[model samples]
Target chain A: MIASLALLAIGLALVVVGPRLAGARWTRQAPWLAILTWQALTVAAVAAVVLAGVTLLIPITAVADDLGAILHACAVSIATAYAAPEFLPGRLLGTVLAGVVPVWLLVCAARVLIGGWRARRALHRSLDLVAEPGADSGGLVVLEAAAPAAFCVPGRTSHIVVSRGALNRLSRRELDGVLAHEAAHLNGRHNLAVALSEILLRAFPRVPLFAVAAVQTRELIELLADDAALEAVDRVSLASAIVSLAEMRAPAAALAMAQGGAALRVTRLLAPEPPMTAWRHRLGAVAALAIVAAPLFLAGYPALSAALSDLCNI
Target chain B: MRPFGELEAAIMKELWSRGEPATVRDVLASLSTSRTLAYTTVMTVMDNLHRKGQLDREMSGRAWLYRPVRSRAEHAAALLQNVLDEAGDRQEVLMHFVADLDSASVAQLRSAVEAARRQGDSAPGDAG
Candidate 1:
């Protein structure tokens, strides 16, 4: 019981402080690593909170002796939660948190997934009717809009849509930069990452950490995509393409090339980062590993102990 | 990739080519040149298009007359608009294919493009 409480407290503290500490400037230098750290933190935080509630509900005596006692207690409490609807208020809250939190989060994520899928299906169908297949050999569709816009519809039949205004406005080099950037987005499957962050944010809107994670992840993916495009185009061309497309919007269902973190991207591009020495990159890797492992170890401790004790007959 | 399926695109093309409001019979007749299509199929497609806000219809005696709400170009433009405006919270940080810049940033972009153009003109081989 004491160990569970300690783990729960540590988990809650990490959730509150992790985002603040991780949002440092160095994250920009190593976005991929930062993203991994954030994802790990989110999973650990949520799991810890739920486990805390579960541990509280299970009588201490159940886990006081060994792992077998904890499991037996957990099973009993879950059954009791369902059978005894009229329990005391404290017990009721514990029962609700332990049983309902996971289900609620799942429902929230499903709603976002299903909603995005339906909207994308409908919008893509409409896009097919109106857009002209562009002259470019690449699978680019042309829209006749005056506003300079370019975006990609990702999935099995991914297509990049560019407006006539954009086609006419962008120089050949700028257009190449934009196309490469959008391709990076599709190839990276960045939408899935954004959607996962969105699910977490939707499930817990009040939690600033989730909101921060969603926004930061969205920005990081854009940065990562830009990094991928750098191999193909000059920094100025990519930055200009992004800057020019700043005003054009696309449907939420499609990942827009110029979406999220434009200012930061432009700054990073135009004033390129001073290359990190080998030691700094190595240090970053170590930090990322530490952040990722901390939560998993803390959250998994109780479960591991229970299994080990039960097997060893201790 | 074609946004619409074969029949939907064919139906749209038929309606777009005809300047006036078309009935199911008119559209089907035009499309039957290369392949045969049932009148009911054309009617259902038109109805589906109407529901999807791609077309508008008027009552003409016993039958309904259908016409595209906008020209093909305008429809294409509107599709872009739909992509822009449909995502409710999208305005803040959603699908921005183009940058939603303030005037200052727009000026900055214009200048940058101008500079790039000048550089391209002066040193043609610089843009590798």
Candidate 2:
């Protein structure tokens, strides 16, 4: 029961404070690390909450030498825990938390995955109808639109699409920069990151951490891709390419962040900064690992201590 | 394996350029100027395109005549519109180079680019 409360507290703390820490401006300097941290925080929070429920339902006394004995103890514990009038509320809550959270997350993930698959298929069909092969050897396709836009559709048959208007507007070097950027996106499999963030946001619409994470993941992946593009093309060319392609009007709801994202990316490109130092990178990695492991540690400590005491008795 | 995508693209381009319905024999003839393809191959591709709703077909004498469902430009425009409109929902499906920005941000970024260019050009020694 104490372990369950501790785990729940840790989960709640992460839900509230993790976003503020991860959303710091310093994260922009290390987008990949930031992405990793965000993923770790999300995973930890979910695990903590689910494990809290599990610990609540199964008492520390349920710990046994064998898996079968442990299962039997857990079944007995759950039945007695539910029957006790004094613990009815906690037991009911535990059952709901453990059973509902994972099921809800899974359902949301499936919905997003199916929807994304259908949308991608439709886009591929449209591309086949309208796109022409580009001069490049890569899976580049040219769309005959007058607006300068470039995007990549990722899948087994991934395509990097550039509008004819973009070809006209961008010089050869600038085009190279844009192509490298899209290539980074495809090669990095950034789509999976975006989809995972979206799933969390959808599952917990009210959680500020997930909302911030969804936005930050989108922005950080772009920065990471820009860094990759910088290796292939000069920063000036990439910056100019971004400026040329920044003319589209985003939806009003996302205007603030979308507006900031392009300007941030362009400025970052124009005035480059060194990446995070080795120590800082290591510190961030350690922190992420600790965050992910803390919940499991809290949930297992009681049983572990009980087993250790029994061994000491022998 | 054969480049089926290239063949489909070539047939669509040929049909769109003609701006009129063409039979498989006619398509094969026009396409043969560049690369030799079997008449049956052309017929199969056109048939596939028609099935995909990219092409409309009508009976002309004993053979089927095929034409693009929409003009090339119209198709391009609609496709672009779909991509932009669906940007909000289907971002995971397509990773755009730059997210759509309002005019104000665009203007801000443009100046930043100019400033960077000036700095880069003024300092010849700088590794930009």
How many backbone clashes can be found in candidate 2? 0
Q: Against the true structure, whose TM-score is highest?
A: 2
For residues B1-128, what per-residue lDDT tens digits would candidate 1 score against the true structure? 22566688888878887878988888888889989788888888889989987789999998889998879898788777766654324312234444454555556655765676577668877653
B65 Cα displacement, candidate 2 (Å):
4.7
lDDT (10s digit) by residue, model 2, range A97-136: 7899999999999999898887777677668777899999
Give one digit per residue, the lDDT tens place, for model 1 in A1-314.
44346556766786789779445877777777677767867776777667655655654333334556656655444433323223467466566656788889899888887777755665567667777888876777888888667887775666788889888978798889888888888888777877877888899899988888887887787788788888999877888787666634233223533333677787787666766567987787787567656645654565555555533343
Q: Relative to the unseen true structure, what is the C-alpha lDDT of residue A30 in candidate 1, on a scale of 0 to 100?
A: 74
Cα RMSD over interface residues, candidate 1: 6.3
Name the regions of candidate 1 deviating beyond 4 angstroms. A21-23, A57-94, A247-260, A275-286, A289-292, A306-311, B1-10, B17-22, B29-38, B44-65, B86-94, B108-128
User: Clashes per prediction?
Assistant: 10, 0
The CA-based lDDT of model 1 is what?
0.70
Candidate 2 local lDDT, residue B89: 59
Best model number under DockQ: 2
Interface RMSD of each: 6.3, 4.3
Per-model TM-score of chain B: 0.62, 0.65
